[model samples]
Target: MTLTEKLTTEFRQRCEGIATEKRSLLNIRAFEPLPADLLATQLGATILTPKQIPNLNPCVVAVLLDSDQWSAGIINQNPLWIVNNPRHTPARRESNLMHEFGHMLLKHKIVRFDPDTGFPLRRQSDEDEATYLGGCLQIPRRGLLWAVQCQMTQTEIAVHFNASQEMVQFRSNVTGVNI
Candidate 1:
């Protein structure tokens, strides 16, 4: 299998209620960008929007606060902040934070310096892994299975998961799942 598929499969196994209806109050965010504050809380991480953080770096999504707060998520210092506005869909923001969390979880740190751009460096695999993990974190394969088995249309799943319709459709194709 391809690396993305492998990583996705591994991540899905971590979920306990992939195929069943959840009884917990914690809702599964589909396409909604989780409120930065709430997401930070859920992950035991903190969000330091453009104003809150100092000594920031470029392309730096956010600071991963390890000592306290949610288990993981970003603290984007500046320009990259996309979670604040209601104009932008919540699903997108939630997905972005999760993606950044994947970066921390995978130990994707700046390893070197790019002389050409004078920027910090990271592995391509690390980048890919973060993106893949982010999506899988939000959309577990087993949950996808349950949704499909329930005959939820892609759009409905998108709303249910707070994910975009496109993501839901793509996931359906990727998992060979049917509704």
Candidate 2:
């Protein structure tokens, strides 16, 4: 498998393991605010912020990039970045950060390439997986499933989990139920 594939597979495994624990996944109340430094450490990356590295090489959480910026990752040993698009709900950011971690874990295999002038970490399958598992990391499938079984609208689920509308929509699709 390619780096992205391998990373997604492994990440899925880790997520499964997390699913095994008996903790209440619905206990997820807020955005699960991840510290930039801690998130970098969790992903095993040395955090380099915009302040430390300047616009060219700052490892950014890009919620909004004009024509020039990408969200997250290391590029050519220079700027490793992530998008901080406010368009994403706070929960979206949480999942997105995890997706960004996928890139870091996967991309080091080949030489770090320069930013594509876009945060194209994973577009199709890779992007989908990242976002999928990112949602799982925030709210596990089992718990969310239980919530669905308990009769919650996608809007209610989104509200309860503090997830984005799109995330709740996707999670519902994965469950293959019409709620």
The prediction achieving the highest lDDT against the true structure is 1
Candidate 1, residues 2-30, lDDT tens digits: the string is 54465555554432232111213346443
lDDT for 64 (candidate 2): 30
Score candidate 2 by lDDT. 0.50
User: Whose TM-score is greatest here?
Assistant: 1
Candidate 2: which stretches are off by over 4 Å?
1-14, 18-71, 74-83, 86-88, 103-111, 114-125
Candidate 1: lDDT of 176?
A: 62
Q: For residues 34-137, what per-residue lDDT tens digits would candidate 2 score against the true structure?
A: 23335445444544433443455433334234322344444333335443444444565555566665444434332233387643433455555555555555
Q: What is the lDDT of residue 114 in candidate 2?
A: 37
C-alpha displacement of 9 in model 1, angstroms?
5.5
The TM-score values for the models, in the order shown, are: 0.59, 0.54
Model 1 RMSD vs true structure: 8.1
lDDT of 1 at 119: 48
User: lDDT of all the models against the reference?
Assistant: 0.53, 0.50
* Model 2 quality (TM-score): 0.54
Worst 10 residues of 2 by lDDT: 22-31
